[model samples]
Target chain A: MTDDREKRRLDNTIMEGLRSMPEVDPPKGFSARVMENLEPKRPSAWTRFRLWLTEPRSVTFTPVRMIPVFAAAMVLLVLGFYAMDTNDSGNGMRMSTIRFVLNDSGMNARTVAVIGSFNSWQAHDAAMRFDDATGAWVLEAQLPPGDHEYMFLVDGQKLMADPLAQMTRDDGFGNRNSIVFVNGTYEQAL
Target chain B: MALLAFFLLSASCAWAGDAGFVKMADRARECGVSSGMIGQIESFTAEGSLSDAEAVSLLLPLVAACADNFPLASFEDKLAEGFAKQVGPFSIVRALDRKLDEFRFARDMLQDSGGGVAQQALVVLGEGLSKGVPRQDFKTYVSMYGDHAPELFLTGLEMMSLLSQAGFDFRLTRSMLDVGFAGKGLSPEWRYFVRIVLVARQRGLTDDAIAEAAGTVLEDSGSLADVAVHLGFTSRDLSGRGLSN
Candidate 1:
């Protein structure tokens, strides 16, 4: 009993000594200096635009920029032609026919098609075909404003992604698909 | 007036001539080299051309800028490359790596040296365990030590042995151990039994239960053996309870 009591007393004294010891402060201004150093310096879009305007010599804007611009203009021109083809509606708002082109790249000898929520996820009847002359797989769909997720169904068994689409989501089965968002009468391919 | 004129002349000279070093400074700044390191490199670059004080002053901002922008690896590489272009590549890489390694080692040493709550916990736990303090009281003592109790306890054991060898009383040793076990959520009974077994094993107690308990609680052979040796026991006693001849 005496030994236990003496041990308790010793323990208390030791604990008190530890508790009484002053905490060692980290070097002063450590966190403040770190925060000051880490402050984000992201350049705004407008700032980027202004920088682009100023530095015409930057390699980032070259034939590369022209290619996108030309493609966009050609897309606009095609839309104009489609609108003229559907002039029979006469009501300024007319639905234009959407044409799609699908190409097969895999060696599986499979029939492929574009499927999306917009097309009720059907593949066989809704699949597009490749235009051999243009060497381009094209899709023309009349989509109302909003966003849509879609993928290419190849050979009825394989699901392929659109390599040229603007955006994608993980399909839980270790694959990704293209997403297109339509706003202001024209939708952007993602 | 003379000083002002000299400053103006220096400014004009700097602006008129491309120092061939401004680009390097900008690159160093971009690469995130430490201000001190940048200063060292810059001074080294300008040593023969500028007086020592002038060179150091010019290099300070470059170093700070580099540290701010570049990560350690990239900054080291760029600094080495810049120096190599002027000095021999081998000499600069070796010197820079040596200095940088020393600084890094010092910082790492400080971190591992137990300057924080973890260290405090270990010191407290060591003290508590050595005195055969009750497990509950030790837990209360170490209640604020946080999530690193296991690591701190393991490391604290080694520290306690060292302190014991240095002739500190059991009061300090037990307190260190108590803090190390603080907030581990182990039951007081288990804590008490564990501490007793550890201490007994350290003292060469030939109890089978005590050896088993020590084996259960401690993972490292060096530490387990250290505890056993501290209590005046041999490795054979730890392997299985056998009376010392």
Candidate 2:
């Protein structure tokens, strides 16, 4: 009980000393300095750009001064067109894809292939797949741009002509070979 | 001295075969024959499709063609075609001989018609000659139209062959080419004369009818596409079924 009384006396003495202190005014512009410190730092580049854009500026107009700019534009346009043309020519050098189709609806052929100058006339090099929907044998080949002579070999024994060939030529071997002109059209004669 | 002479003679003979082979290789390079062509022939021998003697016979004419500066591709292509067709070795040799003759005839014609002919042009003209275009007709066409651009010349020759094969009269064929080469009526796209003729034939237009329509429209500086339209040919007739077909 005596220790509790001593603690209460010390607390009262400190409280009385704090209550006896007098009120005083702060230094001049102290609150203003604090407010200034609280304000944001330097503006960003985007803000400066927006401020510059909103500000007015004068622009001059003269045809003679634009001549160099116009010439540069023309040069750029020409280079662009030249690049486009070069790309087109590169594509032109590529081999054209030609589809060879043989309509063997009634023959019920077990095998069919395309023999032509493009493949050195190999019998089985360009075998055609039988499409059930169309009932035909079909093959596609990449051939250079030129005239190629071809024929359909049916079932490894019979040499058949393309029934819908655009042009047929004498194979000089007593058989007619289909001639397909593979040009820009990518069209197969048959 | 006697021993030295024998060694020198032996060395000369030893190098002779290799020198001949090197010379032949040089000629093949000049004539556009790939060295692999020999490899193909040797492969044939290995495959037993050609005897040693028969292979030599096939190679002799190719070398002769090279020595004469003839285009070897036709011979090469024919040889490959014959082998691919499984025609015997002798048959391939005979075909090569025949092709050599065809190329000779073509070279002679090109020479007779004012020589300065390119190898590709010679090949195209040879194809025309072989397809049965008359020598006189080819000479006239080449003399008249061959001096222009190489592609145009080649196209003209190809058209001559195809049209003649299709039974178009020489004079009418000549006239169409004249209009195409005139450069006033037809577009510069006349470089594709072969394609135009192909589409024309595919449309089933008669030779006389095409000639008539071309004579009327093209002579008056009309467009190439117009000649087909003048003959009542539609875009559908000109168009193909393409890959879907």
Q: Considering every candidate listed, which one attains the maximal DockQ?
A: 2
lDDT of 2 by residue, A1-190 (tens): 9999999999999999999989789999999999988957878999999999999999997999999999999999999997765344355553655788888769989999888888878776799999889887888777765667777878876888787776677654557767776544323221
lDDT of 2 by residue, B111-181 (tens): 77675757977887666665556777777887787567766677667767776765668988878778767
What TM-score, computed on C-alpha atoms, does each candidate reach?
A: 0.21, 0.66
- When just chain B is superposed on the true chain B, each candidate scores a TM-score of 0.24, 0.72
Strongest candidate by lDDT: 2
Task: List ranges where model 1 is wrong by over 4 Å.
Answer: A1-110, A135-137, A186-190, B1-245
What does the interface RMSD come to for each candidate?
34.4, 4.9
Worst 10-residue lDDT window for candidate 2 chain B reads B235-244
lDDT of 1 at A21: 96
Q: What's the residue-level lDDT of B115 in candidate 1?
A: 44
